[model samples]
Target: MSEQESQFLLILFGGIFFAFLMSLFVVAMVILHRQRQVKNRQKLEQIKSEYEKTLLNVENEIHQETLAQIGRELHDNIGQLLSLTKLSLNSAKPEKQQQAKEYVNQVIKEVRALSKTLNLDWVESLSLDEFINQQLHRIQATGFCETSLQSDHSFAELKKEEKLVLIRVIQECLNNAIKHADPSRIDIRIHQNGKVRILQIADDGRGFDTSQKSSGSGMYNLGKRMETIGGKFQLSSIVGKGTVVNLELPFSV
Candidate 1:
């Protein structure tokens, strides 16, 4: 072969080899990007699954609590009313019969009100402020402790799941206070702060130390529930002074 021809052939082969290497590198990069995308998608799916499970659990707990309340009302309130009604009816006086008829009417009204609470539809329709006010009133009615609610009337526009979770958290806090704290007064405040909605539940009860680890996982679970809904739960307590639970929720501007 001639020297010039040999030189040209060598350069041609070298160029071909370089092109092959570049093609391989591009293929490798594409594969890596696809793998990363798949991983991220899987992680997102896992997070969504966990959030859904938490939401279902919160709903069930609230339902059970409602059922319990209904049972108590039926047994304690309605049952007594019925007994009084029977006694009044048996009396010979015409006025006593009239009073018995009134008792029957009251029982009907109480029943209809209780029936309204039997379904989960209220979770979607009830505003956070309204629910908090209702809870406070219920406690006050019990005469166990004085209760009050203060709100600017501005409220969070929350999804049904978010509202449900938030309601359960508040119920748990109130139950804890009444069951353990022996507080004379319980107060709840709801308002907006910039892009955040805030709820503060404060009680003049026997507070416990937040530093000490609790035997039950109630506090930790409450915190996790708030986190799932993109909110924060903070609790502060003193030995004898009082306890306060603060919840902050962020909203889009």
Candidate 2:
């Protein structure tokens, strides 16, 4: 072969080799980008799992606290009242016997109502709407506030975990309204549109400014909890008017 031909062949092969190296480099970069995405997605899933577990623990604590409070009320207040009623009925004269019987009947009625509150199994057995209504009834029974619930659809489609998160969110909202808002009336409404479920809680209480940053973590945590469940939380408040909380959740069949 001639010197020029040899030189041309060498140059052409060099160019081809360089092109191959560039192509390999591009492939390596693409692979690295994909790997990074996988790692990030895995990290996000791990964080979400931890959050859900923590939230479940918090809910269990709340349940225990409620049970303890009920236990104390049963032991100290209701138990004593019932005992007194029984004693009065047993030792009453004929003229006072009728009044004593009426009083005992009233006590019996109160005990039966309180018994409903003591049933923790309702958490698993009842639908979300039923559970929410029960909580509202408990609030009204305390004579602290007038509470009402309206639902356009049932929450039987929700999974157990979804229901737990929702119940916690509802309880948190209720606690905030009762402890801070000092509302006379609280209303909860639930409805569904397509695959989205909506819950709105409104209180005719002395509301605060939503624009102002507060030192409380209740609102922040509530939003985070909803996000963990792939839901959205919104709050609106007007000073001296009222507050409304809207939660939207996506349902899967």
lDDT of 2: 0.83
lDDT of each: 0.92, 0.83
Per-residue CA lDDT of model 2 for 1-253, tens digit only, reads 9999999999999999999999999999999999999999999999988887867776686687567767877787678777776767787487457766776787688677667656455557778888888789989988999999889864667766677778888888898898989999999988888888899999999999888999879788878878877899999999998999999998875
Give each model a TM-score. Answer: 0.93, 0.78
Q: Could you give candidate 1's per-residue lDDT for residues 148-250 as a string of tens digits?
A: 9999865547888888989999999999999999999999988889878889999999998888989999999999999998999999999998899998888
Best by TM-score: 1
